[model samples]
Target: MTEQLSTTFNSLREAWLQHRPDERQRREDLLRLRSAFKASLPQMTEAISRDFGHRSAHESMLAEAMIVLKEIDHCLHKLKKWMKPQRRKAGWQFWPAKAEIRFVPLGVVGILSPWNYPVNLSLTPLISAIAAGNHVFLKPSEHTPHTNAYLTRLLHDCFPQNRVSIIQGGADIAAAFSSLPFDHLFFTGSTAVGKKVMAAAAKNLTPVTLELGGKSPALIAPDADLTKTVSRILTGKLFNAGQTCIAPDYVLLPENQLETFIAECQSQTAQRYNEANGQTDYTAIINESQYKRLTGLADDASIRGHKVIPLLSLNDTQKAENRHILPPMLVINPDDDSAIMQEEIFGPLLPVKTYRSYDEALRYIITRDRPLAFYIFSSSNEPVENALSNVVAGSVCINDTLYQFACANLPFGGVGMSGMGHYHGEEGFKTFSKVMPVLRKYNPAATDYLRPPYGRFADTLIRFLTK
Candidate 1:
């Protein structure tokens, strides 16, 4: 397996070295990929659903299909402009030199995508690499074989094997894939795995863009509307059963508004997800292990005497028979040291913490490891500005959640322990590109007189240039 991986990478590297795609070729490739992806939407949706045990069709369309399509469109529309060399000012010392920066392809790019939102995560980065005129080697999550199979077929049909290839396997293959020498490696998963990927890539001195998850917080100001704030929080949190990287891992609001927030959460959840009527609007946990881990977090909190409120009622038997669907719930102020609070909650369990003052809330967020996303719900500008100024995060959505990632123009990434690097829109293009600066020198250069050995003319020219 390792030998085969090496052989495939070598072939791709050689092929890319021989002939990189030009602007017209890249646009044509993107257009073909977009067409194939659009045509396969129905099958793609079904494959993702099968992989997740019971993924919502609408959610798959909105989060995966629609978002990827929009990204491709954004790239297609902006590729020409992005490809144009950017003119830069040359210093007086090099008076007759013209300078510009060219966006060039960086050989083969390796992509490691996660199972959560598998299609979107894989294809979005692939699109960026293609737009940047690089060959791609992708490895989708092993947990989603169905989706991976579909992706392999779709991508291969649109692009040649040397241009775009998808490899499928478990942890061993992922480790091996990360160790492969590529121009750049892009990974989307947990922070722990991200560290390992970075370390592996370090052996080759390869650059990496890690889109990792952390404990993102949603803060509600004292003057914010509880109804709207709770609704948006639940919407973002419960999307994909809180498996999103930027999902609201916890909530911090005023102490007096705790009860009101809880009430609003329950009301909004009931209205949005009508399980009693047999509407499968909600998504199930990805698999048995994930389901166990989520339940374990809640159990640990409950055993410690923290208030565990279930927004939707479901018995153990029902939860098991329904493919491990853990309903949305709140863990009110679990101890800061508890498992649920310490780790990223990639499930529907939201830990709600209260703050005595707005400053306290900002402090709580600022002190922790910078998160992937920070959501602030406030009507007044003062508290919003305070939070914005103090709390450092990968991205911020003032009154909403997850919308920041949907915007192609915005650069999406994390800080400190959360993760590093940005990818989306122009940032994505640049991330996958090598921005090379070029200086074209004319015959009548200003530095000709200053290049000689110790002489009066050289000294005078140097002095004048320095002055």
Candidate 2:
């Protein structure tokens, strides 16, 4: 496996070096990928659904298919302009010389994507690398074997193996893949694993962009509308069963309104999901291991005397394990030191914490490790502005959640322990590109006057320039 990985990488790298893709070829590649992706939507949806036990087709279309299609369209529309050399002003002393930066492909890019949102995560970065005109090698999550199979076929049909290749395997293969000497490495997964990926990439001095997960918090101000806040929070939190990296891991709101928020959450969950009828609209936990982890989080909180409020009926709780579908639940005021509060809870369990003052809430978020995303729900502009100005996060969405990631124009990434680097939109293009600066001289040399030793003209020019 190691030999095969190295040989494949060498072949792609050699091909890229021998004949780098031109603007036209890059555009054609993106167009081909877009067409192939659209043609396989139905099969892709089924594969993803099968991987997750019962992933919703609607959610799959809305989140995965729609998002990737929009990204492809975005790249196609902006590729030409992004490829053009950007003009930069030259210094007055070097007036005859012209300066510009050219956006060129970085030989080869390797993408290591996670199981959650497999299609979107894998393809979005792939689209960006293609837009920047780089050959790519991708490693999808092992947990989503069915989806990975579909992706392999779709990508292979779109391009030759040298242009784009999808490799599938478990941890051993992943380790070997990460250790390869690629021009750039992109990883989307947990912070713990992100560290390992970075360490591996460091041995080769390979630059990496890690899109890691952390405990993202949603801050609800006193003036915020409880109904709207609860609805938006649940929508983002429950989407993909709260398996999203930027999903609201917890909520911090006014102390007096905790019960009201809980009640509103119950109402919203009942309205949105129809678990009683066994409808497949609600997504299940990805696997038995994930299911057990989520259940264990809630159980630990419950044993510690935290009020675990189930939005669904008692009957649904009995059959939840069999289906691996843990309904949405609120863990009221779990201790700050508890497991749920300490780790990134990638599940349907939302820990609601109360804050006496708005500053207190801000302090709570500010003191923790910088998160991938920070959400502020406020009716008035003061608290929103305050939070925006004071809090530090990779991205921020006012009065809502998850839509920050949906914006094709914004850069999505993390900070501190969350992760590093950005992607999506022009940032994504830049992430996979080598923005090389070039200086072209058109006429007589500007520095010729200063080249002589102990010359009076040189002294005058130096003084004038310094002054």
Candidate 3:
């Protein structure tokens, strides 16, 4: 096994050395990969549903298929321009010399994908890496083994393994994979895991783009329209059963309007889903562990005197044995020390906290490191602008959440504990390439400021310009 692993690594290194694939080849491969990916969508949905036990097919299409296809198209539309060598202005000292920036591809990239967004999270980065003219090694989440296997096979059928490979295993294999010194690394996971991945990449001084998650908050000011607020909040939470990195971790509401927000949210939740048994419009959690973890947060809050309401009420007996299923839960008066509040609630539980005023809510969010994404739901433009201007999250949404990630033109990633660096859009190309600045010498007579005679005139000229 070690011999094969070493051989594979050596092969990739050789491929990277030999890779001078032209623009035409890159486009052809991308188009072929696109067709293969599109063909697998139906099966991908099935594997995701089997992995989560009740993943909504429609939700999968909206979240995964729509976004991935749009990204593919976005890259294809702009790839030619993005691949062109950009002309840069030469300084006055090099008046006759030409300067330009070329977008050279990184040799090989190792992408560690998260389970929450198994398809788009994994494949979208691949698109960027490929578009940037580099080969890739994708490591999808082991938690979704079926999806992982299917992705591997899909790529294998579409392209040669030497150009793109999929490595599958549990944590041990992932640890081993991370230790390898790839040209660049793109990781999408929790903050804790992101730290480890960053440290591993540091061993080889490999540049990385970490897309970690934080407790992203959504604020609803007093002047906000309640109907719109409820609809947007519920839509954000219901998507992927709230297992999204940018999903609103919690909501801040006006003090007296807390009950009204909860009631409206409850109504909005039911309107999105059918009340029939096991026939939910929303998707399910990834596994029992996630389900239990989500329920534990609710149970902890409920035991601590906070009011917990399942927006879609259910029978007690059926609910106990259920896996991968949880009605939208809203926790009222959740304290700071509660587990749900402390951790990134990557589940369907929404904690409601009442702020004394708009400034109070703003203060709470500013105290923490900026989140990957922050959202504000208000009819008036002032509060929305206030939140966007004040908070330092990676991306801000007005009266919505998680939609920024869908726009192929927008750069997606995080800041601080949420993550470091970004990928997506043109930034994706920059992330995978090293921007080297070059300057050429012009006519000797014109560049005589540094003739090195150790004279006062030369020193004065150098000091005048450089200083």
Candidate 4:
């Protein structure tokens, strides 16, 4: 085991040193990876579906495969500008000298990806690292064995193992992987595990970027259209059965519009997922354990006097035999201390809380740890601006959820308890890179007057510059 780990690390270091890629080479390699991804779209979809038991192929294509395709395009298009050295003005003390910022590649960046959206989460960072000219060592989650296996084979066809390698294993391997001294570490998982990863990386002094989950909230304003907002909210929450890290954890709606909001949400969910016996489009919980945990949360809330309503009642067969296919549920005004409210519900279960005013809604969110993402579905800008300014979330989307992560131009990450740092597009490149400030001197005699003596001319020059 020690030999295996050391071998992988040493190979990455040697590969990184053997060939430091320039902008043209980086773009060409990205294009090659891009073509490979597009060609294997069908296989990639099937692999993720097998991992999740029953993930929608359409969802997989859009969220996992195609998103990476677009990201590759974005990188290739912006590579020259991103790689260009940024010139800085020389100060009065160093007049006539040139100063610039150069983005240097960090060797052997370690990537720790999660099961949810494994393809995108794993390769998107890889894309950024490759663009920044770093050799990558990725460790995908063990839960998605099928997808990870496919990823291993697919990446093998594109590049040599020494350049960008994928390591697969369970928790023990993961613990050991985190402790390795990589140039940088990028992790995506739950907040509890994120803390541990951060601690482990600290021992190596490895700079880290953690993309973690929390109880992200969706707030509705008075002037918003329930028709459009409710439909979008349903899509966001039900997508991947709410397995998304940035999915709306809870809804804060107007007190007077509670019943109408609930009715509209249920209606939209049924419309989008119109299946009687079982939901073919609806994603299942990853496994039996996840299903039980989600059910436990719903059951605890139900027992504690919270109104638990299934968007669509599943047959006994679907509920009993097909337990992994968890039905969408709405919890009306769950108690603040309940598990549904306290814990991050990473399934198709959403709690709808009512507030009298915007202040009340904002207060409820502020009292908790800063979330990964926050949303407001308002036509007006005042409430959106207020929430964006007051809230300290990692990212905010006014009138939307989860789409911010799709944009390669935007930096996707968390703040506070949600997690730390960001990695997407240029930010991802910057995260995996060491930016060094370079100073060039054209004339040696430019500093001769102030070098040794601190004489009259030096004093006069200092006074002149200061004045």
CA lDDT of each candidate? Answer: 0.92, 0.91, 0.83, 0.88
Ranking by lDDT: 1, 2, 4, 3
426, model 3: CA deviation in Å?
A: 1.0
Predicted candidate 2 versus true structure: per-residue lDDT over 197-262, tens digit per residue: 999999999999999989999999999999999999998899998999999999999999988998
| Shift of residue 74 alpha carbon in model 2, Å | 0.6
Candidate 3 residue spans exceeding 4 A from truth = 1-3, 276-278, 315-322, 445-449, 456-460, 463-467
Candidate RMSDs in order: 1.3, 1.6, 2.1, 1.6
Model 1 segments beyond 4 Å from truth?
A: 315-321
Quote the positional error of residue 107 for candidate 2 in Å. Answer: 0.8
Q: Estimate the TM-score of every prediction.
A: 0.98, 0.97, 0.95, 0.96
lDDT of 1 by residue, 1-467 (tens): 89888988988888898889998889999999999999999999899989888889999999998899999999999998999999999887787889999999899999999999999999999999999999999999999999999999998899988888888999999999999999999999999999999999999999999999899999999999888898899989999989999999999999999998899988888888776655477888899999999999999999999999999866455566576789888999889999999899999999999999888888899889999999999999998898888988999999999999999999999887889999999999999999999999998865665564669887787688688
Candidates arranged by TM-score, highest first: 1, 2, 4, 3
- Strongest candidate by TM-score: 1
Q: Which residue runs of candidate 2 sit more than 4 Å off their true CA positions?
A: 275-277, 314-322
Candidate 2 has its poorest 10 consecutive residues by lDDT at 313-322
Q: How close to the true structure is residue 209 of candidate 3, measured as C-alpha lDDT?
A: 92
**Superposed Cα deviation of residue 448, candidate 2 (Å):** 2.8
Instruction: Supply the global lDDT for candidate 4.
Output: 0.88
Tens-digit per-residue lDDT, 1-467, candidate 4: 65687789899999889988788778878988988888998889899988888888889988987789888988888888888899999775786688999999988889999999999999999999999998888999999999998899889988888888988898888888889889999999998888889899999899999999999999998888888888888888999999999999999999899889888977888777765635678888998888899999999998998999899766665566566888899999999899998889999999999999999899888989999999898988898888887788988888877899888889988999998888888898788778999988777545765778578888888788889
